[model samples]
Target: MAEEEKSIFFPDDSHKLWSFGDTRTYQRLSSNSSGFLRQLFIVNIVFWAAFLIYFVLTASQPFAVQPLLLAVLLLPSIFLSLYVLVALRSAERKRLKLRASGFIIYAPLSQDVFNEHCIDFDQVRSLRLALHKRHFLPEEECLIIERRDGRSLVIPFEEVLTDIRRSDFMARLSAYRPGLLDLSEAPALPGEGGPSFTELWLHDFATQGTRESLGLLPAGGSLKEGSYTVDGIIGGGGQGNAYLAEGPNGTVVLKEYVLPVYRGTRLFEDLSARFFAEAKLLSALDHRAIVKLLDHFVEDSRGYLVLEFVEGPSLKELVEKEGAQPLSTVISVGKDLSAALLYLHGRFPAVVHRDLSPDNVILREDGSACIVDFNVARELERDSRTAVVGKQAYMPPEQFRGKPCPQSDLYALGATLYFLAVGQDPPPLTNLSPFEDAAEARSKDPGFAEFDEIVRGLTRLNLEKRIRSADLVYEKLSRLALKRRES
Candidate 1:
């Protein structure tokens, strides 16, 4: 093969790369090896028959007493069968173990290894999904990649090797790092990478000689199949139980709703509309400060969401712990929350977060705010909704009359700040009853002076009089914080 001829035959595009996965290798496992094993079993049965026949002949009258050659051959065959049986039992255990660790991608339809650059195992960091998952757990099913430098990169494995070829990854691995795997024997396609920590644990757990055992299933579950385990109970809404789950791959928020409860909702039509709509709203927004949706699934006959778990507390909790946050803190939170709303309101169908309370606002470790909980939120497609969405205390006067707008959210932010500083809901809203008529009633109470002005601005019975925008609120809050510091 001349170099020129080889170059002409294999041009650059002679083969292209595919990462999202192309189906070139997916096929049923061949039955030839199984047929061979069956034949071997038949051979063993025949040898056992021969041994019995020789014994019977010797026992019969006038039969030859000794058949030494038959004994010599029969003994070896018996021993060989025993050895093979032991080897097979061990192989089954390993197969089951590998299946438990992660999704066993049964070699995509196109299972050719694209080995343009041979990987060095020692240089590999954790392999991860390029695109964060929307409906499926990406962390569990992603490609195992290696990086020589701090920069991460995934190798296009499918186009280079055949999945069923079994020794392809092992051969490639050993060529780079001899004796990479613990066993003297090389690994199959899925197990080609030197035994990972997860793989090792799976092996130990899977092969353990015990009374009961478990196997891998989907991250999300259906009534027929249960899902992965839940590790933490994070938050719960009226719809379902929200939990932090130990995903087969990574950290996920498991939203488990009782089956019978879901089928019996009065808001069935509206709930279904909002349920999928929430997922859609989350998928559309890609801003950094906003919470990201990693994946979601309906499992164990219930629904769950895999969210990027931010390690911090919510603004409500912050206010609770500190009694009241400085005005500066409120402004910073308001800015982020408002920006998110602006994005939501401008979206195609227009997302309206009906519940805009502090409890739903999470404060990141870096002191940034993120608004969450769109469970009760409604969408107005082309603008038309007679109904309203918001807590009574935070709702503007127009809302009580069954009308709300973007200004309603700003009013809520004001009420939240007043509550944080004054340690009470607005006096007017709280005292909508006959006895406590208005601010005059609240002003008479001890410790009322400190919050009188703040409460007045928030408790404006008229929506027209409430804080109109987050921009205005941000500026006022910054000024208050500055004044407080100087005094």
Candidate 2:
């Protein structure tokens, strides 16, 4: 941890971002909360009501209450009230800067954020805190600050009260004015020229979004033999868990779609068909780097797809556990990846793995890359095409306008390589969330000029301007690998 700090930096953390809590056991209230939000509820109601009445009575236009104006005022007030009442309820994330030790990082979300980028957290006076009055309330409170920035980060103190370890965190923070030493292991590297790693983490300390209250996991009961036995859970996304399961005589991976009833049946069926269709399409093709589809089934009124289960860690896991891998791992993985794409694209009706991120690719025990989660939207009926099946960030711009093709897959591939080269996820295309992860990653480690150049060629926002094909990516990567080997 200390070694990584030397090579990293963090932006000022004066401003705070979102917060959450775990219900320890999935109850309506997350366990990390302190119920401070409930207290804030009474306080906010009384304060807002008092001021709102006074303002309405004296205002020239009265309580204009337009959605737009009301929205603007309520937004900050909500954040403020949450900070005021729910002390340490929410965890504050620096949108721009981070504070170092002894000193507070002063990166502001709205103004002069760049100034706080390089400042050391050690030099700052205090850090921010997310406070809440209750476990269920969405509002938060702001308590700690090097000085006074008018905002606090989120921290679930109420629910944490019951957790001995979490309660210890509170006790530790109490000793230091700003709070306990920040505890994030992620490099403080804030993308751009921000505070050094040590400085940024100086104020890093937070609680889990939810507090686990004694009992959360289901009783460890063995079930009678069933059709399938779940193996290792590989990963999860908007879809569901990707588990290695065994059925009949062979091993396979199954992806189940768990969703809220509100998503509508149309969306679920559409996703299921698309998944099956993609598997079927992939099944028809044989590629060294691609996982094969053995069979698919639907029973018990549930949706699930089965495919070959390749063993080994994912590219993302490798990076997190062991920084950047040798170019050999990169090239070997890249070669298999490109070969599979080449085969898929050459098909009479080309296939596209629209969401090609590290999480979707696995490093097999045989030293090859196996692609997963290729979307088969084309296989679906026209009615289901608009349901949105791919991971937005890895998708090309064309996808945003409702287009999926081979080129779209290449966009994902390019993004995948960029992530490999930089050790970070790319920016997302979906609007449901924000903050481009790819851009932030690149800023963190530009690497060599050639490497940076490669990332640029692959991840261009403009499809036309981006590297044209799988073959081209392979060719460039081959040359890059050869050059690195010689050097």
Point out the worst 10-residue segment of candidate 1 by lDDT: 93-102
Candidate 2: 10-residue stretch with minimal lDDT: 21-30
Cα lDDT of candidate 2 equals 0.51
lDDT of 1: 0.48
Over 4 Å off, model 1: 1-228, 248-250, 257-268, 381-383, 386-388, 428-460, 474-487
Instruction: Give the per-residue lDDT digits (tens) of candidate 2, residues 324-392.
Output: 555456666777788788887777656656667787788988888898656643432221233345666
Top candidate on lDDT is 2
Q: Candidate 1's residue-wise lDDT over 83-118, tens digit each?
A: 765444322211100110111222211112211222
What TM-score goes with each of the models? 0.44, 0.45
- What is the Å distance of residue 276 in model 1 from its true position? 1.3
Clashes of 1: 20
